[model samples]
Target: MTLEAYNLLGWKSETVNLSFPDEDSWRLDAILYEVDSQKSFYWLLFTGGSISIYLLIYFIQKDSLLKAIRKSRLLFTILFPILLIYIDVNRIEELIHLSL
Candidate 1:
């Protein structure tokens, strides 16, 4: 179950009274807010960088659009799995261990 689903179930349950200490509650909220804001900022930065690079490539290779697209596709295909593996290496290792 997802965090939201779990939270909803907890809310519906009569025994679940989720309350943190006052100082810790504010600190947790602040940390969550900071994490959210940082994620948004990083996402925006990545999007802007991608667009800028695409535009630059488009401008530089105006006549070779097909070649540029092919190169981009190849690059993405090669990098995508590497990125996925990099991000999920821990999960992948856990699964391998479980299987063994």
Candidate 2:
């Protein structure tokens, strides 16, 4: 279901076969907005691709694959609500779709 899972199944990219550990330090990140359907594709492809590729590369080789993913999702779950509050308080335009 995820890139890390795919990596465990032996799929790999040519550019970063042995570089998975270093790549694990990164995650999906972007500047945000209420994207229209057109812009949403970039967000999905880039974010999902980033998340999937990183997971595939990193998790395939790591012993703690599920732990890392759970931690990330947990952190995001805890943090995003506060971010939404900040946006609502300040009336920021970024990522309005998220609150919706």
Candidate 3:
């Protein structure tokens, strides 16, 4: 259905069916980019968790995984910049605390 929609929308489609990693894989990806900053932590955990939730929801939808991902992609995209700011703020706080 999603593929059909994409086609109807006149979006260029990729021949390769790229896939997202599982929850465990996402968690591992999160670990790789771990930061001491709280924002970074939240962004990492939230996005990873969101992806996991999205996948779960996608499974229940009985639609293509890619289609489900297309819908859920918004959450990560929307929150990414906010998470970066969060990490920056946390980093500042840590620097202040160290200076005090």
Clashes of each: 0, 3, 1
Question: Which pairs of residues clash in candidate 3, taking residues 3 or more apart in a chain or in different chains?
Answer: 39-87
- lDDT tens digits, residue span 1-100, model 1: 0112124255633322234455545544543454455455556546655765676587557657666656455455445544543444444334333333
Cα-based TM-score, every candidate: 0.38, 0.26, 0.30
**Model 3, residue 74: C-alpha shift (Å):** 6.5
Ranking by TM-score: 1, 3, 2
Among all windows of ten consecutive residues in candidate 1, which has the lowest summed lDDT?
Answer: 1-10
Which regions of candidate 3 fall more than 4 Å away from where they truly are?
Answer: 1-56, 59-61, 74-82, 93-100
Tell me how candidate 3 scores on lDDT: 0.52
Pairs of residues clashing in candidate 2: 3-56, 4-55, 4-56
Q: State the lDDT of candidate 2 residue by residue for 21-55, as single tens digits.
A: 34432321221232233244445445655665566
Angstrom error of the Cα, residue 24, model 1: value is: 3.7
What does candidate 3's lDDT look like per residue over 1-100, in tens digits?
0111125477975432223346435433342244345446556766776666867596648877676666566556556656775666555445333333
Candidate achieving higher TM-score, 1 or 3: 1
